[model samples]
Target: MAEFRQAGGKIDITATKAIAYHEVVVIGNIIAVASHSAKIGEKTSAYTEGVYEIKKGNEEITQGAKVYLTTDGAITATAEGNTYAGIAWRNATANDVVADVKINA
Candidate 1:
């Protein structure tokens, strides 16, 4: 494959803790999904705007259901009048994973 101009790229940051792939991470007010695994003090990639399998909270999420960002960096459906993270790209059970998510929250 040939490399072209940058369409989207991940920002480099020092991981304070272990970050898994496809997990939602927030830097300041910016929300992005982890593109690669990174341990504490390691450099890794994270990007926004692409579909990703993000960690879900205790609430069950249905297809097309809207989700929100929890305090722990997981996506949830119980914002309770707060801002949402994005919409569910696939049906997900509680404590399971939600696939096909795009950042809208």
Candidate 2:
């Protein structure tokens, strides 16, 4: 079988604060991940337009579920008061530190 799908592009932004590598951050639908360590007010590599493998804390998420950015620079299933980051591309267990998401930034 043959199939075709779409992916995302990389974008950079000025960090509001220090961000670790692969940490997910979101301001509304504008989601991104720090490609490397970036200090506050410095330009860091952020993938705002592409799928990213981000860090998820102890929270578990299902496949195809919508992921949100937390206050502590993390991803989770709870979006009650969080910023929408992207969609989970796979199911993530509670023990899994990483979650795959197709970011819609």
> Each candidate: what lDDT?
0.72, 0.79
lDDT of 1 by residue, 27-96 (tens): 7655777878899999887886756776666667888977777787677778774356777888877757
Q: Where does model 2 exceed 4 Å of error?
A: 1-8
Location of the lowest summed lDDT over 10 successive residues in candidate 2? 2-11
TM-score of model 2 vs. true structure = 0.70
Give TM-scores for every candidate, taking all chains together and pairing residue i with residue i: 0.61, 0.70
Steric clashes per prediction: 0, 1
Cand. 2 Cα-lDDT? 0.79
lDDT of 2 by residue, 43-77 (tens): 87767766777778897899999888777767899
Residue 53 in model 2: lDDT: 78
* Model 1, TM vs. native: 0.61
lDDT of 1 at 92: 79
